[model samples]
Target: MSADTLITLDTPTDGTTVSGSFDAKGTANSPEANVPWRILDAGGQKVLHGHFTAEGWMDKLYPYAGTVDVSKLAPGSYTFEVSVDDPSGGEGKAPQKVDRSITVQ
Candidate 1:
């Protein structure tokens, strides 16, 4: 995590072409000890969801790597999102969400 950003994805970059299942990479410093991800199909439907855990969470950011299964979706366009786990702060708050647009070839 940077001073200005919560999480960042380093692979399957935005507006990139991909095929089948691929490795997802990023880094984050989340209180949950893990960061969540969601893969959405062209019509904005969730195709897969999971989380990535680093070696351990400290006061600094840690690296996260995971695999996203895209073998079943008849995809043309999809969004791969990685977000620092945002637990509610006891108020009406939204979770942090970052997204990458990917096309399945």
Candidate 2:
């Protein structure tokens, strides 16, 4: 039950100038068969959300990579919450989360 998944968002600028992507790496983790992720602003607003399939179980591993767009968002701090969904397994054992604050200004 060791799924070490990593989600990263990169914004090199401020306001509408900032834009980047989200990435995941499941190889080193417990190999998540299926998982969902969501991006939120500082005010707990939903910005973006997505899910992944465990198609490449053997070769790909768990930590997969994804992308997002944050340029249109206003200048302020934000947060991200990634939820795990493994129908084959139970709850709490599959989900993983990571949080960070960023300023668009």
Candidate 3:
């Protein structure tokens, strides 16, 4: 995963509820399908990170989704990213990153 991925953050009216989804496209007729994601703050700190594995319907769906808790976070900006990775030196591909700046008040 590169450092240029984009993660978009959606802020609701409640200011404490935050949720969104991401999609990592799969290859054509390929059995490999998975996307790793990470949520981080402005200080390069990791808030949450995980991998999602789901089958697609003939390259019709990318299948990536997650929900984050903003109640524990202070009023500030943050970043989220998703990437396709393999442990066998194939994880250097460009990952999707989304950065969002939010204020509590």
Scored by TM-score, the top model is: 1
Report the C-alpha lDDT of model 3 over 6-103, residue by residue, as the tens digit: 22223322223243432333221112555565667778788767755545423443444444444556656556554544445655554443334433
Ranking by TM-score: 1, 2, 3
lDDT of 2: 0.49
Clashing pairs in 3: 5-97, 6-96, 6-97, 6-98, 7-97, 7-98
What is candidate 1's lDDT per residue for 2-87, written digit by digit as tens? 48565777886889887788888877777667888888887788888888886456576678898887888775888988887766
Report the Cα lDDT for residue 8, model 1: 71
Superior by TM-score: candidate 1 or candidate 3: 1
Per-residue error for 21 in candidate 1, Å, reads 0.7
Instruction: Please identify which of the two predictions, 2 or 3, would achieve the higher TM-score against the true structure.
Output: 2
Alpha-carbon shift of residue 75 in model 1 (angstroms): 2.8
* TM-scores, all models, native as reference: 0.83, 0.51, 0.47
TM-score of 1: 0.83
Predictions in order: lDDT: 0.79, 0.49, 0.45
Off by over 4 Å in 3: 1-31, 57-61, 89-105
Each candidate: RMSD: 2.3, 5.7, 7.3
Q: Spell out the clash pairs found in candidate 1.
A: none
Stretches of candidate 2 off by over 4 Å are 1-18, 22-32, 54-61, 86-96, 103-105
